[model samples]
Target: MIELVLPARRKDLGGFEVGRVLPAVLKRAVGPFVFFDHMGPADLPAGIPRTVDVRPHPHIGLATVTYLLDGEIVHRDSVGSEQPIRPGEVNWMTAGRGITHSERFEKARAQGDHVDGLQAWVALPEADEEAEPGFVHVDAAQLPAFGEPGVHGRLIAGSALGLTTPVPVASPLFYLHLELADGARFALPAEHADRAVFVARGEVEVDGQRVAAGHMAVLATGRATDLVAHGAVTVMALGGEPLGPRFLEWNFVSSRRERIEQAKADWRAGRMKLPDLDHDEFIPLPGDPPPPPNPMS
Candidate 1:
């Protein structure tokens, strides 16, 4: 059953920062998901410019999903795929063996554009870690929408309301983008009893407990759960089958220790290609070394 796991808002850092996260995986080894980041629903004043300049970075053993609630992003990958992802659209990138990419604004927000969205990383099984890299872009109209008046649900990934996301993935998982008007209440499936809710906009009450914006509400594992929107609200729910043993090193994710080690070496030796970008300010630099091996291993 779905159980509330994480209940925390994205902590802000400085410039261009909305929320930064290294989220906890509540069940099993990272669960069926790994990384989740709640970005902006931040507003930009007219005539002020802003841009998302995530430099080229490498990822392995996972697929990345970029969904926008407002604004647009131009995604470019090492494989030469470039696409503009607008509101209600998704950019799903699968980095089987390994892939590098960058996400930046299509145009300066000051130029009358705005930015708001979430970036998620879903892990792949051990066997698919080294598969070829690929990507799929799904428009807003293609995703399934359901729920009663005053409350709406968008199935960004996995299946809901008899509809499934068009992006190919490795496991059984669900990513829901939902919004509810004030005074609206909705029920989640009993299977999602342990799910976590990240409140991006406004406040909500789960099982009678109130949670405001910038905070997360983790539901205790049990039967079906209920939530009421105290105001206009937006939340993202991630649920899936539990994952097995895995390790994260830098941006590389793998189930095998040796594979992660090799990925580190490959990156250090410059064997992997970086995503192309017009500016160098956003490029990702090499980070601190990985942690020591597990003593029990």
Candidate 2:
């Protein structure tokens, strides 16, 4: 049975500055499913400069998924892979034991561009945490798309509705991009009752509750939930078997405190390799003094 998990909004300051996070489930209970961040579907007037510079950071025991709705991002990692991720493509990177990587705006759009996308971190089971780092880039045409008229479903990862995304993953998870025309009603699969929906483009009605862009709707496990697009709506659905409890400090994610400490030491000692980028621009490391407290606090 599917159930709804109420979504919570969290704000964090990172190398890129302001980040708004809408977490559907608590990290402790959602095994393998750890960090999820919903980025902008922001409209940029022509010639407005946009940038996404997430500096070289270490990740362990997890895989990162980058999906873009519009615009493009250049991704570079320690493994020497570099690629520009655009709309309808998937950039899936697995940091088995540990890997460091960075994300920044593509050079062509660096001067004046726009972007719309999301980044999610999926925890790897203990068995694969230290395996080896690898990457997979799936073009937009490779993902499976289904659904009736007025509604279209794009499978970004995992299998759904007789379609599957080519991106290989370690867990039995599903990441879907769904678009619904105004007033269109769609039935979600009962198998995905535990999933969460993040509205990225327009308002949507799910289980009788209205969720607007920038907000998240968590559907608790039970019977399948129905959604109606209040307007032309775009949403992302992510779910899998829950992950075990883990610790996330700075950029390292581990199931044990000692492991995180070791990772920190390795990074500081230069034991870990930083991601390779064609350009010299790099993101600064974390641990700088916090900015002045918010006056509104």
Candidate 3:
């Protein structure tokens, strides 16, 4: 029922902190999730600019989904999409062929807010790797919800425990967010070929394995795994059919390493278009130019 536990590597993204869990040296990806980052349980000081955080950057051959637990973010993309995502909502952006975007904390900059959430990159199938890039934003009310007694959850994408979200995904996958009251129990659905559980808050015991916050546990298949919450907890459970092997570097993911190299040159030569709304400042390729100033966050 349990395979291995991967702890998040804490990193300070200038102003706040980010916990990078996936693309691990131990496991590069779980199912279609090639990259995963726990973005700050850290506070953002008032007026924290977007440049201090993540500037406009490009991605290809993947979809980026950001689900926040607190605060809000303004997402601007090359597809002419400008949306603000609040806690409980999801912003799914597909960089099929190529796309660039920027995340700015507008409300937080004007009025301080907390930034806490999980962001994951889903690898596009080799067939759809060159499809047209797109973006979608689903409100919390649009996602499917389920619960009984102390267990309450929302299905972010794909199917889970008899419920499914309308969120459009390029592949078979299930991303769930569960909030369990202390003493409550949960059973991870075994509907997918690969499954993983991430403890975002509190603690839990899964089949005698104690999984604490800031850690992601890879679960074995074959049957549902039972877990009990020691306290009120937030659990993110996700998995799906694997997309075979993928090459990931910086912010690009592809099936062939040459594709990655080509993406590098494309970005270096300014072949990729910036977000229509955020075109002034972009994060240059590593070593291309000096970095931005670290503002208070």
CA lDDT of every candidate: 0.71, 0.71, 0.89
Candidate 1, residue 145: the lDDT equals: 84
Each candidate: RMSD: 6.6, 5.1, 2.0
Candidate closer to the true structure by lDDT (higher is better), 1 or 3: 3
Per-residue lDDT tens digits for candidate 2, residues 1-297, read 224434435453331322344333343333255777765544434433333356567787789899988777788899998889999999999987788887766443435455678888887777777779999999988888888989988899886666677788886778889999999988777575347777878988888888878766666775677888998999887776765767777667777889988987786666777775522333334664433333322
lDDT of 1: 0.71
Alpha-carbon shift of residue 65 in model 2 (angstroms): 0.3
Lowest summed-lDDT stretch of 10 residues in model 1? 277-286
State the lDDT of candidate 1 residue by residue for 75-185, as single tens digits.
Answer: 988788889998788899999888888776546443646678888788887678788999899988888888898989999988644668886878777788889999998
lDDT of 2: 0.71
The candidate that wins on lDDT is 3
Lowest-sum lDDT 10-residue window in model 3: 288-297
Q: Candidates' TM-scores? A: 0.84, 0.85, 0.96
Instruction: Rate residue 70 of model 3 by lDDT.
Output: 88
Best by TM-score: 3
Error of 1 at 92 (Å): 0.6
